[model samples]
Target: MKKGIIYAVLAYLTWGFLPLYWRLFTAMPAWEILAQRITWSFVFVAVLVTVSRQWRRLKSVGSNRRSAAAIVLCSIFISLNWFLFIWAVNNNHVIETSLGYYMNPLISVLFAVVFLRERLSPGQWLSLFLAGLGVLIMAVQYGHIPWVAISLAVSFALYGLAKKIAKLDVLLGLAGETIVALPVALGYLFYIQSQGTGTFTSLPPFSIILLLLSGAATAMPLFWFAKSMQLLPLSFVGFFQYIAPTTSLLLAIFLFNEPFSEGNLISFSLIWLALIIYSFVTFKKSKVKVVPISRADAL
Candidate 1:
């Protein structure tokens, strides 16, 4: 349990601090950065697969068309999520990005009800109500939809659902997704270079190195997260999931100096309150005491 807690904390901390890492590539367009992330992450994971002699697992994925289709869909969703997040961080919307992650668990619940046909408890319904109210408040306050937050939450939730249904293990599943995305990423990089708009050509060595490091940044936390989920209870893992967005919120306020309007605060407060209620209810009611399952348990 202690080891699980430690691993989960480390994973969340890495994710929380990722904005700072991506901020290093602020000179590049978000698309280019995203492309590099996908490409290099593919390369990195491919190397890991080779080193671990997990080639058979990759081969096995090719035997199932349904799983391949699900993974392709998951890849699209995750790619969108990654691009939006990087854009948000670079474009001074880190707080909004944080809001999306803060709202993700609620969004997952909604997805479960809608697509999975799972019934929600009364407490879960109330939590969703509070979360909806928070979004409405934020929309009213901003005089527009909080699309960044909404998009992030929805895309990631959908990605999680796809992964859940596909039932692929973490490393192999991610490898499949990245491989599916690899061609598009490479093609984009190629086109950009041909157009002379690519950042890679003119970037400083340190910046180039940082871009390469995006692969490690993408993979390591996921590995830790998968390990932690294996070691811990789902409810406990769910509770620790808040650490990432909480850290992002702090970084947004103090480091990036983003304006936290009064309205934003109120909306966030409502969401946090809802999460508290949901977590408490879930912990209290969950009595199965089953071991955590290993197939993409969380996003």
Candidate 2:
């Protein structure tokens, strides 16, 4: 339990600060940065697979068509989520990014009810309604839907759902997802390099080093998150999920100085109220388990 708590805190903290890291590549294109992230993440995880001798497990998973297909779905959603997040952060939509993550748990709940036949309490339903209302308000205020925020929320929620379906060893599963993405990532990177638009050639040596290190930066938090989930109930770990978005919201408002208008405030407040209800309900229903996670708790 202690280890799980520590891991969850670390993962959320790292994720919370990730906008700052992505901001370093603001001068670069989000596509190229995403390609770099995918490529390097694969490299990083491949090395881990080698060192930990998980190659057989990896092969075993690849041999299974259903798990392999699920991983491919994970790769697609996660890749989209990664690209959208980087683009949003670099393009000064940090607050929207924060909003997206803040709404993720609610979206996950909806998916559970819709796809998994899971039941929701009355409190949960009300929470979902409030969150939907908040989103509708945001759309009305913006004169269009906040697609960045919605896409980020939905993509990641789908990624989580796909992960639940994958149901393999965490590291091995991650390795498979990256490997599936590796080819397209490498292809796009080469295309950019050939077109002379690649940051790899034009950026400072320090930036290049940072770009190379982005792989490890991308993977480590995920490893921590997986480890934590393996040691804690989804409901308990889900409680910690708020840390990332809350930190991102603070950084967006105070550090980035994004315009937080009255409408934004109202929308966020409603969503927050919804989350409070949701969390209280979740906690009331949750038991404090001692680090014996089950397959049912995979996501």
Top candidate when judged by TM-score against the true structure? 2
For model 1, the stretches where C-alpha displacement exceeds 4 angstroms are 1-11, 224-241, 287-299
TM-score of each: 0.85, 0.87
Estimate, for each residue in 1-299, the C-alpha lDDT of model 1 and write its tens digit: 66877888998889899999999988899999999999999989999999988989888886789888988998899899999999999999888888787767666666666776766579867876886687677667656777998899889778767765676777888788899999999999999999889979788988888889889899787667666656654434544656788899889999999888898788878877876887677656664444787768764
> Cα lDDT of all candidates, in order?
0.80, 0.82
Location of the lowest summed lDDT over 10 successive residues in candidate 1 = 232-241
RMSD to truth, every model: 5.2, 4.4
Query: What tens digits encode model 2's per-residue C-alpha lDDT throughout 66-164?
Result: 988998998999899999999999999888888787667667766766776767678878877887787667667667678898899889888776766
Q: Itemize residue pairs with steric clashes in candidate 1.
A: none
